[model samples]
Target chain A: MYEFDYRRPNTLDEALEALRTAPDGKLLAGGQTLLPTLKQRLANPSDLIDLAHIQDLKGISVEGDTLVIGAMTRHAEVATSPDVRARIPALAELAGDIGDRQVRNRGTIGGSIANNDPAADYPAACLGLNATITTDRREIGADDFFTDLFETALVEDEVVVAVRFPVPVRAAYMKFKNPASRYAIVGVFVAQNSDGVRVAVTGAGASGVFRVPEMEAALAADFATGAIEGIAVPQDDLNSDIHASAEYRAHLVGVMARRAVAACG
Target chain B: MTVTVSMTVNGEVVSGEVEPRTLLVQFLRDQLRLTGTHIGCDTSQCGACVVHVDGVSVKSCTMLAVQAENAAITTIEGLADGERLHPMQEAFRENHGLQCGYCTPGMVMSAIDLVRDRPDITEDEIRKGIDGNLCRCTGYHNIVKSIKAGAQAMKG
Candidate 1:
């Protein structure tokens, strides 16, 4: 690993200041991704702005119908938090199923969403449930927050503070994860609310996480596993690799959607 | 540039000057000479470097040494009390949980944390909870037995 300056700030203002002052700074949340990337020399930022010490950027709370989670909140906390489990059990279960226990102990939802990994689980939850991402500057809706593969609406020096997830009437996430890394090969999140039904698919899209209008519409009409039993997404845009074929992924999307719907009950 | 990072390791206040790129496993094995912590895989998938940071199991290889500053780290060396082995270690020994012993240290460390956090940890839970710690010796049956016994012992 290459040498770099490390900055640990105790306050949100200080962390933002550090990011602003550095020549090329990377915000360190759980360091589950950044540290490994740094070790491999994939990213060589001039400085690392450690967000672990920031006070306000940690915790989980329920405000009426929404669950507000701090950016620095670790995946382990989200998985085990009583408040989150009570409010959004499916979200908690998704958090619990992320890359093994050791990884979850250090990985954060904010970091996971901020990185916006195409295979990550949190993006599906955020998009499927229509969460609001609150950055240090402004609030960005879930639909607009994720722009592309490993990308977000966040600009340089813009730190994500918290994400607010509206509790759905009934929701669940099911993923066909890669056994080795536990990354989703084709994951589907089924969410139903008063607004309507939102079905999000991750680890399949060529660009990133996206909603399936057909599946959403079908599920909205019936809100059951049988409704989307025959759902078929385009195979041309899904991911195809040694582990799975694009056609297989499209098939799995339908299968996972059914499972997720069944799980919602 | 190197920085001084101080943390409580195995109940000892240890401080070391390391580069920002220094992983906690490297700091323990190379700098602190606590070689009980092993580095098995490069991609951080193998949990041979698993250790407790502030009472939670985490991959030491995936965390920078600077990040462990002011945190309490429990490595394989910290499990034993003087001459006696920790209950988890004893259970592993009694159950023949290791073959080559390469993954034992990390396996035991992870098991202790698993039982500590989840008291009623089932066999299925143990399989899932210790999913991070991979045993290349290919001895998972005894490892599961050891964890169940160790968890019960820890409760006693």
Candidate 2:
């Protein structure tokens, strides 16, 4: 790893100030991705502002019909929180199934959504459940949060504060995981909210997590495994990797979506 | 180039001075000489470097030593009471859960944590419990069995 200055700020204000003062400073939230990137020389930040000491960035609470999870809340916490499990069991199950115990324990939801890996599971949940990402600067809706692969609507120096997930009537997540990394090769999150039925697909997209409108429309009419029948997502915009081809991913998307719908039921 | 860090490691208070860029894994292994915590993968994929930070298991490889300042940590070395093996360790040994033993410490740490938090853990839950820790040798069958046995033992 390249040499860099490190600062552990106990308060979000101090952390934000450090980020504002230091050029090319990266905020270290759960470090599951950032540290590895730094070690591999993929990222070369001049300074690292560690967010672990910031108390405000951790915790989970229910606010009315929304589950408010702090940005720094670990996946393990979310996965095991009784409040989360009772209110949004799908979200809890999704968190529990993310990347194994270590990753769930170390990786934060904000970091996962901010990194916006196409194979990541959280983005699909965020998009499918119509969650709102509250950042240090502004709040971004799920539709506008993820910009592309490993990119988000967050500008430089903008830090994610918390994520607000509106409790859905019923929801479930299903994924075909890559054998090695355990990342989703193709994952689907199905949810029925006040807005209506939403179907989000991740890991299969070329860009990043996205909603499948056709599947959503079908499921909105009649949410069932059969509802997704004959609905084919275009393979042209899907991702193709050694684990799966674009067509295979498209097929997996439908299969996982149906399974998720069944699970939701 | 040096920073002062103070944290609770294995229920004991520890203080040290370290380089700004020193990883938490390095601190646990090199600085503190707590070598039971292994570093299998340079990336965060392998759970071989897992440890509890404030009762939550995290990948030590991804964190800077300075980041854990004033935090509470528990490693594989802290799992047992001196001479006795932790129930998870015993279960792993009995179930043939490990092959090369490289990932054993991490697997044990993660399993102990999983069992501690969820007493009613099932086979699928055990499989998902240590999903982050990779065992190229065991194919995870025995690992899952070990976790199940360990959970039962711990509960008893």
| Candidate No. with top TM-score | 1
* lDDT score at residue B22, model 1, on the 0-100 scale: 89
* lDDT at A246, model 2: 97
Positional deviation of A119 in candidate 1, in angstroms? 0.4
Q: What is the C-alpha lDDT of each candidate?
A: 0.92, 0.89
**Clash list (residue pairs), candidate 1:** none
Native interface contacts kept by each candidate, as a fraction: 0.93, 0.93
Q: Taking the tens digit of each residue's C-alpha lDDT, what string does model 1 give over B1-156?
A: 789999999999999999988899999999999999999988888899999999988899999989999999999999889999998899999999999998988899889888995567899999998989899776699999999999988887
lDDT of 2 by residue, A1-265 (tens): 8888997788888988999999789988888888888899988888998887788999999999999999999998898899999999999989988876777777899889989999999999999999999988789999999989888999888899999999999999998998878899999999999889999999999999999999898988998899898899999999987899999998998899989999987
DockQ of each: 0.89, 0.76
